[model samples]
Target: MRFFALWNPFVFVGYDIASKQQIKETVRELYSSKPHLTATIGFSFAGLSAALSGAVWTGAVATLIVLACMMFRVWMEHHFRARSSEDVGEKWVRLFVFGSLLSGFGWGLSGALLLYGTSAETQAITMGIACAILQGAAGRAYMTPGTALINISLVIGQMSIGAFAEGNYIYVPAFLLYFTFLASFIQQMVDNRLRQLNAEQTAERLFREITEKNELLRIANERLATKAYEDPLTGLANRRKFDLALAESLAASNDTGSTISLMMIDVDHFKAFNDTYGHQSGDECLQLIARAIGSSLAGRDSLVARYGGEEFVVIVRGEAPDMAIAIAERICLAVRLTSLDSLPSAPPRQTISIGLVSSRAGTPETREAMLAAADAALYKAKKGGRNRVCVHRGPCPGQQQEQDTVVPFDAAKQA
Candidate 1:
């Protein structure tokens, strides 16, 4: 008897925890598919079980009390659902108090009945079942300091009844000791699991936030790299990218016995046009030339760039002076066709003068040397007259003289 009293609280606490876990899982599964039907069946089963158990062992009074408690629980569930907007903690607290009150009253009445007329075994069975069912359903409510007081009151009432009938007051202290240790163990386990679940949820949320931030940083880096290496106005490779490409093309030319050709293009009288029309119209003219030049070069080894101001550069691989000259002529013709009426000047249109230079593999000239030679030819074109293509013919009198007389184009005025 002493052993039974000592261990009963622990056993009851373990059963209560297991039962609550099962009920939570079951409710989740049922709610996912058939919430209304599942809840209705669950309440009906609980009410029926409590009623039958009470009637079989105790009496009509115990059965009535169990039925009334079940009905009150159903009503409280409805109230909670209706006030779904209320704070969940507050709602559960209210439900817990309500459940404890019902349990205390039911047990108190049973204890009295046992002390006056019923047997010890019957009283214990009825009280245990009633406590187990009520605790399983209302465990969330007892998440407060008040639960300890309620539980103490219950243990005292049960012990007093058992002691009064048997004349062995030792049962009172024995049951209290057993119940305290058992309830403490069960509460610790439940609390540990809840803490673990909370930690897992927090970790998942933090991981998702970190992933989103990394993706945003990746996109931002891509945009920065593109802006750094690309020309914003003409949507072409900028001068920096052009310089890198020229170096690579020169290296490849040396390795593969390929020739590299460079073309330097200057929009004819661009400054006069910009002054005549406005900065906006000048920008439109530059955009039109960029489009025409880009359209003229369609090979993988050819690249066009907004070299500087109104000047553009084209690099072509595996092409000789004649082929490079032909491509320059094609671009010149294409620009002539692109109507520049947006320019303040009317009709007979705007044109570009191009200078072409070709360097065969193993040539003594570097990429910068080739570009200087092309610029010299471009100067000769401007000197002779604008709007024509000039091919560099290696250190000729005209090419050297122009290289000496070359003047830098005014970037701001070139528009």
Candidate 2:
């Protein structure tokens, strides 16, 4: 019962029913195999052998028929092979069916012409060759089972005509029984092939889905990381990331005996500005100042971040005190140049006070000390009438003035 079920002609195994695409793809597979080519070459060789054995006319004619069938098969392959499975139409499939039947007819004629009315040994050889061709047809049944059936039946039926004419009563029932077995075998081959194709397609679909999901997961992680360390309004590094960077820089400066500068920048009179021009304008003003400060330090290797409300910080590595002061001066100038036309009843311009602190080689350093010194310098800058750069290191050598380290804003620019 199990054996019958496995090879049952009416039983279509695998998925509920094959999709149209799968059926078309199976039809396309028909063009992928070239069993007929091998059959053509083998018959040609056998024809030549027969001619050498003194059956000249029979051998020559058989060779011609085999060559013609080979040409038909080649033409069918060339015509349809370039078309994709999606492009395969019903008419194209019917044309292929016709070609298979014609080729089978040619092979049957060639076999009958060569082996009919021969000795018992020759008759047995003919039957053996016919059975081999039938098996080849069965193997390809998965590609186009209906076409295979037509080709197999036509080939055997044509050859059987000669066997019946020769009064070979024994060969008839033997051929019929063999045909039934082959029919069952062809059905089983088709079921197995369909199952295999389904498995491959399912695996491919799963691979694609997994790849897409992984890409989406990677993008989500990137977004989460950005929100964790980025200031939303100003697009600068937030205080959390700023503290981490400042600590790392201070540690490297202490270890390598190098210098690093810290600048604490505060928007001057921001509370008064917010009172005069609503909080909406205040936020816009801060955003503009942030961009101006970023532009001032564009060419320098520094990390500019939002320290807190109305204040920002910058970290510059490997710079001397003078260079650090100059950078602070640039920030003062850049913020003073920010346009205020957008704010209602806005002042002529906006300004920011920057405090510069540099930790040189041999200085006992810590992030806390650096932050405190920078904050003290910023307080002095704001108290010294604002819009200036003040250094925490008191006075320069040979300077007599109390505010020697303070870079006062250019009064000439106010004119």
Candidate 3:
């Protein structure tokens, strides 16, 4: 019974009967892609072989007939396209059976008519080729057992008839052995159909799971990358990001023969503000200062980053002497305007002391040198009193020069 079930081409062995409609749909979809192309090539090759074998007029007629049938099937599909899926499916099943019947008849006719009275060599060559073509049809038509079995009956059955009718002693045994091969071939096709369907389902499930996992991993990596380069407190670029941006800007400035500036900004008397107002209030002060500085450089190609406790760095491209001083003044003004009176004893207004340095295109200075120069200017601002902007130009020298300029705004004067 197992062998019989395995060898039976008549049984439509697919998914369970409960999923009959789904099976039909799957089979139809599979057939839709390759049938027309297969028909055209198969018929053309058969017709050409006949024509070369000196049956020009008959071959032409046969080729035209095959082409007309193929075109008719194409028309059949389009005609039933807008109907309900159930109706379309029924039509597809019927159309496929009819197509198989037509092609099978063509091959059976080739065997019945062409093999009559031919020599043993001609018969072998003719029927052998026909059997090979029928094997291919079996594979292509296996989605519907009725279609494949009908095609197999017509084409292979005709060849069997031809083999015995020739009455050559060797011909009958030759066909019997060939028939055994045919049984094995049909068994394989039936088994392969089930295997292929199962494999497709497994692949789809695995693919869906893999896609979900990949998306989650992509989100995790993005979060890790963001936290690495961002300051947690003020929501600005961290010092590491600041250093990278400064390096890139310096390289660009060198290529364009322009100046790129780095400004070191420190909250004036920040330690005193924290001591009097508490560390919580001091954090609020830093956040407000960062917002002000970011707002000051909003329209320019500038980067402002949190550079450690109560310190910030700003990188700007172009001439820095005038621009840096102006940006620093704007930052000081923006911070001073913010009202952060969380406690009674807090200072009336917060101010930042900024030291700015311009990296000239020809200057022999690195990013660290620019920071050091800006730091020197910041120290000068602290020495000359707080609430000020100072500019330091030229190379990164060890000593504070007399050419550095300071714009001091006294807390008493602002009040």
Question: Best by TM-score, which number?
Answer: 2
| TM-score computed on alpha carbons, candidate 3 | 0.68
| Candidate of highest lDDT | 2
Instruction: Give the alpha-carbon lDDT of every model.
Output: 0.62, 0.76, 0.68
- Candidate 3 global lDDT: 0.68
- For residues 116-209, write the lDDT of model 2, one tens digit per residue: 5545554555566678888988887666666666677777777777787778767678778888998788767766776786777788789989
| lDDT tens digits by residue: candidate 1, 184-282 | 644554555556555665787899899999999999999898788888889988999899989998888878778889889999998987777778888
Stronger candidate by lDDT (2 vs 3): 2
**What's the lDDT for candidate 2?**
0.76
Model 2 misplaced stretches (Cα beyond 4 Å): 1-102, 173-177, 180-206, 247-260, 271-281, 317-323, 339-341, 344-350, 359-369, 393-415
Instruction: Estimate TM-scores for all models.
Output: 0.53, 0.70, 0.68
Error of 3 at 371 (Å): 2.0
